[model samples]
Target chain A: MRLASKASSPPRRRQSFTEFLGRREVMPFLLLVPVLIFFIIWNTIPTLWLLGLSFYRFSLTSGRPPIFAGFYNFDSILNDSAVWLGLSRTFLFVILAVGIETVLGLLLGLLFWGSQKLPGRRVALTLLFTPMVLTPVASGTFWRLIYDPTFGILGSIFRGLGLPSLNFLGDAHLAFGAVLLVDIWMWTPFMVLMTLAALASVPKAELEAAEIDQLSWWQRLRLVILYHGKFILMLGILLRTIDAFKTMDLIYDMTFGGPGSTTEVIAITLYRRAFEDFTMGWSSALAVILLLISIAFTATFIFVLHSRDRKQASLAEEGA
Target chain B: MTTWRRHLYHLLLWLIALVFFAPVAWIILSSFKTANQILAVPPVWIFRPTLANYVRVLSDPGMVHSFINSIVLSVTSVLIAVAVAFLAAFSFSRFKPPGTNFLMFLLLSIRMLPGSAAILPVYLMYVGFGWKDSYWALILFYAMFSIPFSVWILKGFIDGVSPRFDETGRVNGASWLSIIAKLIFPQVLPGVIAALIFNFIFVWNEFLFDYIIGGPHTTNVPTALSTGLYSGGGVDWTFVSCVTTLYILPPIVIVYVFQRYLLVGMTFGTVRGEV
Candidate 1:
């Protein structure tokens, strides 16, 4: 009598363990393993090493290896006046740059929002985005030339106006403001791009209804434009804020943390600590603090994005 | 809007565009000016344009070497990143292994970390391994840093591909790897190209790591320009302008040609879902 064939043939016996590893179910893990390993080696390990280094007293220039210094590195950084100053200055810079960029970007975005019918909008946009695409280092270099006290264009303009030529990058306050201006110039277009995308998605019917109702400008903004654009606008702000915090290449090229330490932001301070001072352990401590601040910003961004998404989902469900 | 008001609005928009374009135009124009003309008070708008600065910069072997280095580093890093990211993204889009969300979050967080924070340990590690100024060091760092972005973007693109296509391939006895390589990849080729271009532009413009880890042997254009400017006592405005012009050419051209993709790439994930 023919034995009833197993409903599914008994699981095929693998010739070797390697054949089992080649199964379809394991394919994803196999493909992902290499990338995961890379991330662990490059990103995870370095981060942990940085954390470990923070607790040690290691100087590259010193003959001795790293000595475990307990909390000394952390304690010194916490009490250091320079570190505090850098933090505050960075905060101020982020505020000024991101604030101005948001306003300017929104205005431009609104201008071009439904104005696709308008002449030269495409060309105008391309021109506006030119600055955003340029290498930040190159932008910094060009701006440095522009802000040159003697022969720079701004200087010539000042002279033309019968005013004393200002030292744009020389004076302590001016240097900070100058860097802020460059940051705004380079990034405002980014704001405009994101804002424009958001604005494009604004329900045209609502806009027409507001127009028919003769709603005030503020009312139209509140009920039509902003209602739709808030999520993307906030996203743009969050991204810009994080990036503004990471502003080092521009500062490195533009001010080198300044005529003194006037323009020294946290990144610059960290750089000096690690490279200039060769205080490996201390700089690593600063790096850890900087990483914490970045994580905090990123976490807030993700939190806000998720809540917005959920809110949108619930609103859709309510509409349904 | 009234005709006059509309006209005025158009004028204002044009003015804004002009303000943004002025600096870029000035840099390009200055590249053609002599040093005296570059520094001329009441700025020289009309002058006999010269290619002297361009010739001078091109003639410099060191500048040419850095330019080549920038090209090599950026292209190599982008290719490696795209290849690795495509495989991982294919896996993510297809199989979506357990804890994919956690892994992705981890990757993004690392990408978001300040380069300075990561660069410190990386710098030390490089020194310890005697990898300073090595092409592999820069290429590997750039490729690794870019993988998260590439994976995110490429996975989004792959997700857009129809699952039925993969199923059909598998029905025809195509292995997973063969299906991805033959069917899905060709369909997502545009996205792959976009990712490649984005990574290229990013690595090309990168400065901090190039500044710290890179030295004379491996100096890229940005590092070279910055260092030259920082160290040179008397600034040669014309020469600097020429170098800046040359430095920005490739990115500007790429952005102009691939404006749509470049815009999405530059904005990360913010504009993609909305538009």
Candidate 2:
């Protein structure tokens, strides 16, 4: 605040353009302009375009001007079975992926955290983080091969064990589960990392006190561990939810909404409309919905980060 | 802890690590096998290695072009993003105006706009500007996407550094730019490097914008691997193996090199604790 005031303090004399631009108040805003322009052009305008175009019927290939159809797209969306199907599938994917990842992550993370005395722990952590860093397309593409009924290693192993060689990705009933497994495989490490971070936020004194008080394991976990790690866990959940909900590239590379639309999430739906069918206006309505949902998640994410930041700052102030 | 329990944890850590790494190992091993060997019924556990796959992928001009393009675009965009994000982060950390937090949230909301949601509008906008297949479009857009994340991470790092450094630099008659570059930058170099590494991995891995907006001229590795060369003949296991192995090598090295900082980088600096 002091700096903010000094930055805005009145100038005594006329200054050159460069000097004015270099002024404390001016420079920060000046530094911001490039990024500001970037967002306006890339994000803001396009979102406005998405909102506006959703009210009309427009196509890329029809060689026709947009025909205004007020509430038609939204009205149609209300009755659109594909839209409903995609949303339901997407919600299912988000829930299953996020839920499983969180549980697995917590268990694995607790194990990793407790194994501080374990040799080669650092190497294990590095290896565990490997999958999360790989390109989703590459991971999905490779996983696609791995799920092949004939040539895949998994298939061969399955046959060797006297089990049927099922086409993991080709079967409608199995495709969603197969994709969900890969999502878990890829993202579980992220959850683990977040879990560790959350646990790190738990003050050691509190844990020692809990131990001295002889609280039951569940009581300790529920009252102290979760209570402290809640925000970070929520942050992780929000992050995973958004990413899982918007998952397209992995699905695109894998089943591609195959086996009779069994795995078609909303992201894939949006891709189909905009790129495959070239229905710009119709997809915009869908985009608007996605935009809103993501905005809500982003709001929560920012709020969590903001509140945690403030809490940390206040804690530091007290320590000082 | 009991000795047996400690030993059990050791086994568990090794087992977990191996399970996580098996897929990656399989992909790499597949790259060294013949097409027939790769598809063997029982799966070839021990095979005579060959460089034939690498030879084929590398000899292809298209693969080479896209791979180089991926490096150039990713490195360039990440560098630009780091520079701009650093400046902005420094400003927000030091000269934070009123409602800065609100503004920052709005900035990040734009950042969170999913690619598919904005694909239509962005694609249309690119078409309007004759930017499809343009180098500047990708370079700029990649930087744009990376900026918000970098700024967030760098801001956290910059916040950790004391304001006394700023005052000292000012007292030394240094300009703000110099103070940023000479003083703050060195202090936050780790954060900068973290941002650079992760951002590079991101752009390198990005598929959609490159595949849709890129043409013969601008195709990056992901775009090429998906729709262009390597897989042009339709899903060849040997082809995928070669491409995946070569493609993932850089990321593998990076993750290993920055193993300690991976958490901070991965979490966008929300986790500042050392590994």
Candidate 3:
């Protein structure tokens, strides 16, 4: 706080306009103004336009003044059968994808955490995370080939096993599942990285005490690991949820939201409307809906984080 | 029995690791194989590997041009993003503005804004300014996302650095920029490195904006490779793998050589744990 006051302080006698605009206090905001304006024009304006567009009958190509159709778009979207279907499918995908990622990430974190005792743990962790560092476009293409169901790796392996080949990218259910698998494969290690960091910082004495008390491995994990790692786990969920929701490159490349919109997550749908169809106004509305959903999740996550921070603070105070 | 269980656990770990990394491993291995060899049943592991695919990809005029384009555009964007984010993060850390929390929230909210939502109007703006198909178009657009990210991650780092040093610097009659350069920058150098590396990899791999904004002349590596793969035949799996391996090299090499920095870089500074 003293540093902040000192950082914000400046010498007196600034009579010129140049110096006035150049004051330390005003300068940061000045440097920030260009970006702030960019956000207002590029981000905030479109969002407000989208909110307005959601209340109207809209199509980009028509160029007609959007008739204020009074919740018609919302009504239509809500009443549409495919919308609910899409929502349920999206829910299933989010739950399943996040579920797999969390479990796998936890396992991987545990492995790495255990490997801290072993030689060459860093090398092992690096190799494990190579896939996570890959670009989604290339990663999607790599998997697309692997899921070929003809001469692809899995296809060949399945044929050797006397099982019918899985049409990973062709069937609706399979395609959704394929996307989820790709997401998990691509991202689980990220959770591992974060969780491993979180776990490493866990107070070793506490775990030792739990063990001394004859607590089993599971009990130690439940009592110590989760308690220390809660912030990181929440952070992982928050980051992964936002990312999975906005995922575009893979869906765009692998399925093109196809085999008939089965893989059409909201990101794909929003892209189609905004870019392919040129319905900027309506697409903005869809974007707003997505933003609302993300904000809701983020808000909940933040609330949890804040309360946890407060709880940790009070505990520290008590311990003191 | 306990020894057997330990062996089984090790076996399970290796098996899972293999499963997790197989596709990537396949891409690397297949890049060396001929197209026909790529599809060979039982997957010929002992076959003589060839560099013909890499030769072919590199010799392509378009591919060579895009390699340069990707490097220049990504480096420029990351540098600019880091520079601005450094200042913004400094301000955010040192001075509590009137609406500091609101502003910070606003900065993060930009990440959640869909790219498609802004692409069109930004494209229109580009056209108006006659900046289409130029490196500036991509550099500026990418910097838009990178700046917020740099601010978010770097602020977390800077905040973790205690304010006492800056206070001491000011007591010696140091200017703001001097304080930043001497005290804060050195203190948060690792954070800055992390932010730079993240931005570098992200821009290196960015596809959507590059595809839409970059026309034939200004194609980045991913755009060129993906589109070129679909040019005449069905997906040129061999060439695609080759290009991917090449595309994946820089980041891999970077993180490999600078593994410590990259690992420390990925931390959001929340793990400092009171020291």
Candidate 4:
């Protein structure tokens, strides 16, 4: 009943000032207003502006008024080989990077979870999680140095082992993997951070109850830990996917989509399109497409999560 | 679950962490070495250290200015974001307003919006208003960008705190502001701090907007690092090593101080709680 009722709240307007202040809704509404105003300015307006620009032929660098072009920008962008190439590459990168990070993160998080009694766990965790928060510019800059073919550490290590130093960033084939490696280095810890949270949020009482009921360890993990951790874990995955799709900072800093455009993803393409090329209308069209894709992703995730919550609530009601 | 297995896990964790930390450690170590020693074959595992690099980088006006800008911009934005988001989070958690789900979805959608998509209009808007190279352009945008996350994290934390505290505060004839300030604020301070650090890192690391809208007046650290300073012919690894070494310290230091609240912080709180 409580779960059912939380789904709906009627909008209240025209209340006396004191009466409004006295109500519970007033607190949330009042508290949220300042932030709502901020986001309206910073987020919504720009997004809408971009959408408007998508339908017009415009360029900031060009000294001319925006000519309204009906679907011309969108049509041209769809036919652009570079744009499609960027999108496909970005998708592949997101899949591989997020996949590896999730697996590695879960493995490491499990290790940490089981190592609760282990010595120096805090220090290890702090050290490991540092990369996630490190500025991409710094990480990229440092990694670039380390990846330097002739005079860098990796190069020296190679030479010491009687091997020729490889030009990782300059090699077309190697550049993508090198960039992906740095991504894994930076983001895998984020997965570990979230995994720890997810695993921690697994209700202790539920696990104990499952054990007492003679459930196998596997069953306990599945029915308890996975059940509770799925939302956080899914959220982590979703956030990473979105972020990885937008990744350009690391690539820009490290490779600049170089060695023959091998590492150029959607973000790089967008950057070059809007910033360098200054094709405002066409780039805005691409941006609109990308935004729609992102929105579709988040909307689907929310829909699934909502349905799962409802099903679980009903299941709980039955059990209760 | 066994003792020996736990020991093995710990050992494995140590090894992986070392591998993960190796690049940063090597660079920081290299920062103290002479330029020749830094690029030495066999990597000069053991070397006499010096502060020459630090001295050189610190003396550079551009590097110092960018560092100061990075610190000021990040701290200010994250602080504002936390202060606003905290109240909003408190509201979201406590009041459970109608359309909370839709409201939250709208919030997260904003978070999910990529920077590249909006850079066109934002850059143009800034240019038109003569806000180019202004601190407000960055500070306000970063603050806005940080809000959804701060709220999400803070709301999750506030959820963990019992509403009984509010009830208790109210019974003592405390006003909402007093209860929120004196009662709730202390309870969620760790969460607030965690949010601040995270958003601070986000703003600090962000360079695209800084590159576009910020020019001579507001050159942040990333843009400073990017502009052929560390690249192209005649590169200066010594200066870069110093800058990189310095850049790495802030996040690690923040983590060290906020280590206690990290688990609570990193947990992607219940953005799904409206259900």
Model 3 C-alpha lDDT per residue in residues B1-275, reported as the tens digit of each score? 37777666666666666677778889999999999998887667778999999999989888889889999989998898888778878777777667766776766666664455446556545654777788776787788777776887788788878989878976787767787888889888878887898788888988878887778877988887667767775888888899899999887777665565554544434333311
* Model 1 clashes, total count: 0
Candidate 2: Cα lDDT at A265: 90
Model 4 bad stretches (over 4 Å): A1-28, A202-228, A304-320, B1-9, B161-173, B228-232, B271-275
Question: What TM-score fits each model?
Answer: 0.94, 0.94, 0.89, 0.89
Best-fitting candidate, scored by lDDT: 2
lDDT of 2 by residue, A1-320 (tens): 99999879986777888677778779888877777787788778877887899999999899899999998888888799999999999999999999999999999888787767668777777788889888878888899879989888789888888999999999998999999999999999889888888888889999999999999999998999999888888888888887888788898888889988999998888899999999988888888888888889888887788797798789899999
Of 1 and 4, the candidate ahead on TM-score is 1
In model 2, which regions exceed 4 Å deviation? A1-16, A310-320, B2-4, B229-234
Best by DockQ: 2
From the highest lDDT down, the ranking of the candidates is: 2, 1, 4, 3
> For candidate 4, lDDT tens digit of each residue in B1-275?
78787678778879888888887788789899998987776678787889989999899898899999999989998999999998888888898888777777777776665667757678766766888888888788878888887888888788879999999988887778888899888887767777887787788888887898788878888888888464567668888878988987887887777776555454434432200
lDDT (tens digit, per residue) of candidate 3 on A235-315: 767767766766788767888888888888766776776678876555555666667776677566557657777888998
In terms of TM-score, how similar is model 2 to the real structure?
Answer: 0.94
Model 1, residue A145: displacement in angstroms?
Answer: 1.6
Q: In lDDT terms, how accurate is model 4?
A: 0.81
- TM-score (0 to 1) of chain B, per candidate? 0.93, 0.94, 0.89, 0.88
Compute fnat per model: 0.59, 0.59, 0.29, 0.61
Candidate 4, residues A229-298, lDDT tens digits: the string is 8877887788788888878888988888887889998888888888898988888898889888877777
- The full ranking of all candidates by DockQ, starting with the best, is 2, 1, 4, 3
Give model 3's DockQ, 2 decimals.
0.42
